[model samples]
Target: MQAKPLTIITQNEKMRNIFSGIDHIVASDSSILLIGETGVGKELFAEYIHRTSPRQMQPFIKVGLSALPAELLESELFGHEKGAFTSAGNEKKGLFELADGGSIFLDDIDDFPYQLQSKLLRVLESRELMRIGGQVSIPINVRLITASKNNLHDLVEKGIFRADLYYRINVVPVDIPPLRDRSEDIPLLAEYYLKKFAPEKEIKIEKEALRKLILYQWPGNVRELRNVVQRISLFASNEIKVEDLPSEIRNDHPMQSLTKACHRCLTNEEMTFEEVVACLEKNLIQQSLKETNGNKTQAAKLLKMNFSTFRDKLKKYLME
Candidate 1:
């Protein structure tokens, strides 16, 4: 049973070794940075850390740093004092104070601007927060767990982020690999979602459908797979059939958009400019003629070429 949202799988020795050090990672009195791609569940992993830690009973404050306007993010994180801004009527406690004695998950941490890095550095260093425009610093003991879907090294090289701050937070780095790299787990994930989603809609997933699902690359990762399974379970029958797949996946989607769309790619690579043009002209003429029910004049108009020119191109391609 997966007790946490970020189901930490110790499937391999590598993962087992990594997870073995998880206690040290979470128990450290310093900031922990979790890095992974979008949709790979970085926030979920952060939640796991909070849930397993001693501060599990305390509120787990979630701060979406990227969602916040950069101008006001610092104020939101560190709190604001009276007259700090046009709307600053009263001194407000930031996430740090609100999450005192608990864990704070800072999602999309890379979006944090360098301008506020020093302010954040102070908070991390002092274990306290000072509201904007406030004279007195408030002591707040909050464990910080941050996640980013970006390459911090690239940001550092570009000089957009502070190197000192990056090193401070990256004391124990947890990098989550994408779903594609772990295709071996696709069947497992599919079955899990199938069991979860099937009962609500009275449906059963077909083994063949599961096979197809496992084969395709889930670009959107687990989230995308969950969506697919959800839809299938909702619309499909007690015994799911291959034909019951969503129309997009059921048919040859790439070619059916246009009959000649597939052919375009095939012969384009081998044909010279004139040959390619001739092929395209033939295709257009044939398509227009078919749509117009073999009416030459209508086909010519559709092709936007005169009857003679259209006929000439058609014959040229046919003979070639």
Candidate 2:
């Protein structure tokens, strides 16, 4: 049977370039490693590779390695014969066997147990496996696609991941850009999901609401956006207003916004304590002035500083 075409709902140029690269090599069987933060849709990218590959008609199995228990991971990936363990009641094919002549996506490969790395490497190298308690070695023909939220190279450097296996899987690496880096796509995605979840309603996002969506950093990426849209769909009126957005998006927490404003000061290692303090103070003064409509005395009072002290600060920070 023919596999359904993979649909990646992205208008971002970074994503487009990534997909273009994937298309160029989908015909090859090289191991593809997808690197992205959690909920950045690594699994979707894996499926895209599989569905567009020469083995599209073949089975495409996906396994979240982090979700599986450490004790059962080996057995699950390599299969097990009946009586292999106390809980083993029937012989079964491992994911690799089931994905013969196909692709198997291993999400969170960084969480794969260290001791089992060698066994996994052996399978990838030899294209064969020996099920637990089975004598015969089963030859397999499967394409391996793995994903990691952490840089596998960093894990290897720390000795948590095997270097050999890291080299094996790092053949074709693809780095997915986070949503915050591609704000242009926010409106398109929000509109698409709104239509999907509220097909019966003429739901639309107000300009202010859409602006907030683009401004707020989506730490959870596309998944979080989808959830937010789905939740609002149930309660939103025909026009989704800024007030309809979750508080986090509509109004960032004061501290969060402050931290963002002072990000450079906080992260720059060369900045001294006094410099950082000055940076924070300047930002606070600017914010206070904006809030008080340029009323220096009111700004000073709001910041709990004497007018004289606030005047000196304004001059010091070049606000005067």
Candidate 3:
């Protein structure tokens, strides 16, 4: 049986458009690219596509690209021989074969290395896969869907990502705007989780607490919000109150500071709030670099920034 597209629980026109776009792309065999921030429910969107796609009856395989090492990732994607590696106990069909007549979700495609990109491209183009430790190739009939939190175009510019591969997977691109950008959807999503989690724990959220949840920026996004609801539900009376909400949101300092810092720079064009915060962030990063003795890479992690983002910030701040 095919899973139906969960009645889209949204009213925002932009998000509604994204849902329609996904609905359209699923009907064909085109490889799709879903780009957004972490905790943005990319996988849920993938499931929505698969359930609505023509291959709904077949397997829906998901490969977490970030979880596997290069050598293992290759075999995991395109299965290897029984004795292909030091620890091969049995022959396993690759995800492509498992998903034959269905769909394969390659989550976190941004983490794919240069070496494995070529093999993936080959399989994508020909719809064929070879099992590890096997000498023969098998035909594969599956749709591809990839999700990423990183910008593929930036990766291409740095040569870490192959341009051709980028084009291949990016054939049908869908952008999932962050939760903060789509505040309208928060109340609905919150109520969805609250009811879903509440019944499991025999608790309920007061109307006011629900409103508080709807107002927060939720930097951690849906997942974090769900966790907050779950945590609060455990201790919440049959009726949850504002006092029961997580302390972080009630007294969220970093966000408060960030919010305050942003409000102060609202009128600056050349220095948008993001730029201002980033400028402050760059200063912090530069301090880390100085402490680390001019090592930009290490300084990046110290500042909790992506290496590339850190480098870009360095250039933007004229630190280099």
Model 2 collision count:
0
Candidate 1 lDDT over residue span 1-320, tens digit each: 22344555435454456556676666665678888767766777788888777777787999888899988887888889889899998878888899999989889889998889888988888887788888888998888898988778778989988898888888878887666557676667666777777755545557876555555544466677678777777776576676766554443322233356337844667778877766666676666665444666555755568777877876776731
Candidate 2 lDDT over 153-231, as tens digits, reads 9889899999999999999999998787798888988988989899999798888788889987676789999999999
* lDDT against the true structure, each candidate: 0.73, 0.88, 0.77
> Model 3: per-residue lDDT, tens digit, 1-320?
65655656777888889987777767899888999877888888898999998888789998889998776787777887778788987887777888889989999999998988988888888878677677787999988999998889999999999999999999899999777678788777766776776776556567777666666656566777778877776676677787887764554333343444445445566886667777666557655664334756545654678897888877888887
**What's the number of clashes in each of the models?**
0, 0, 6
TM-score of 2: 0.81
* TM of each candidate vs. truth: 0.72, 0.81, 0.78
Ranking by TM-score: 2, 3, 1
What's the C-alpha lDDT at position 142 in model 2? 94
RMSD of each: 12.1, 10.4, 6.7
The candidate scoring highest on TM-score is 2
